[model samples]
Target: MENKTKKNAVVLLSGGLDSATCLAIAKSQGFDCYCLSLDYHQRHIAELHAAKNVANVMGAAAHKTANLDLSLFGGSALTDDAIAVPESETAGIPITYVPARNTIMLSLALAWAEVLKSQDIFIGVNALDYSGYPDCRGEYVKAFQAMANLATKSAVEGHAITIHAPLIDMTKAQIVTLGTELGVDYAMTVSCYQADSHGEACGLCDSCRLRREGFAAAGLADPTRYKKHV
Candidate 1:
């Protein structure tokens, strides 16, 4: 039987492969997903467009883009024009790691969830086969969830907020397989760190490499548009 009283969930949709798959998972769990996209004034706006497309096609109850210029701080490669996004893998956390990005995005999502009286917030932060961001770790997510429950009025009144990181443990290939099974249109998602205005990937950045590898590992043809194609 179809769930008559669908619970609301706030999903942080980044228009990336992981986030798109996360949204699909939330929908599969019978939540009326409210997609949230952050316009942090990153190097590219292509992912924002992809986010909108994913939200619409995936049947999100609502989609909202929050505007905050993280570029003003200028710390990470994604936000700072001075820092170049590396095409090759490097040791330690890459410069592409935005400072406290996940924390900031989740805080925004938490606020929206409170207003909507939604107890769930979904973030697509993978650990395995990832770019080695500190915030994407399981412990960080758990800590944030604890803080959220303590800080929110809803949680104080007995409605505890749950932070869902469904993709945290899944490998890139596993995520690809799962998303495929869930009917996700991978082409609509953009995971490139240096995507062009038209959303064509550079096909050399860390993100593009991972995404391509994932599809290959899953024995699926990558549908991502590369700069070569343009």
Candidate 2:
């Protein structure tokens, strides 16, 4: 049964499959979802467009885009034009890992959550089948939650904040299955690290590979539109 009073939640939406699923999960838990997307000057601005579409389609109470020039720092491939995004699998954390990206995004989400008087913040950071980002790990989420509780005025006043990562331990296939069960339109979500202006995926990047494999494993047809290569 649904709760009579729906609690508000701030969801960090990236317009990707995982984040979309995360938002669906939050709504399922009876939270009034407020979707948050960041325009941090990444190569694929297409996902930001996807974010808006997803938020509307998923019935979010409100959606907001925060603009910032993370490209000014330019330490990673996504934000730096100098570094190239690798099409093939690479060892270690990969060049596509934005430095402290999840931390920064969560900080923004925390601020919004405090202002909205929402104690729950949901992020879609998966540890499995991901590009090996350090910030996506379980420990990182726990540490961030700890910091958020201590740093926020709401927490100090006995309204503790919780950071929810529903997909943290789930495999890509599992996430896909869950999202499908929740009626998420996978076609509207873009997981590509280098999507074209039209939001068509490259279908050769690490993110694309993972997404493809996930659908295959889930026995679901991939609905992603791919760009044609010469």
Candidate 3:
């Protein structure tokens, strides 16, 4: 059932709810998806495993994990053991923001996209119902898209890379509903910022709170696996 004429797309698959939905959307759009996940030594590294499973089940043409130690330059709680992931919401951009994470991930995806002759790159960064990560904004995505076009050799040769952020303006409930309609398995994705080794979520984190609320608001039973104590 593969469409030989379908264009290729590089998807930044973080193995989270949003990214998984993004992949399904890309597939639905008739693109041959190439999923890219990062192994950045995050506290919730279990999400990488979730990413692999999600990519496989979603029928990605290929999946790659680019290994890098982002913890070395860690200024955020996710990458540094010294900092604690705040269970409650904090003001003015929480400490969980990884410095230049989306930018770095996009650069890697762009490299593979250029090599694969793909003109599309998909990221599931949402502005609504999200932790206040500045990189998740629509304006940031637009700026990055402009920069990508100017920086890539492929773009200079008339092939422009389009950065897709399908969930940028959507509420979490809307996203969950759309993904469910697209046949995405929400349970297979992990959104916890500090998941355990078995991929069980700590329901107290900001990510978990949003996810839990999303399913509730959508009137769908949340299938996320949380720790027994949570």
Tell me how candidate 2 scores on lDDT. 0.94
Candidate no. 3 TM-score: 0.97
Give Cα-based local distance difference scores for all models: 0.95, 0.94, 0.95
Q: Which stretches of candidate 1 lie over 4 Å from their true place?
A: 1-4
RMSD of each: 1.4, 1.2, 1.7
Candidate ranking (TM-score, best to worst): 2, 1, 3
Q: Candidate 3: lDDT of 105?
A: 97
Question: 51-117 in candidate 2: lDDT tens per residue?
Answer: 9999999999999999988999998889998898899999998999998889999999999999999
What are the per-residue Cα lDDT tens digits for candidate 1 across 1-230?
A: 33678999999999999999999999999999999999999999999999999999999999999999999898899999889999899999999999988999999999999999999999999999899999999999999999999999999999999999999999999999999999999999999999999999999999999999999999998999999642
> How much is 5 displaced in model 3, in angstroms?
3.0
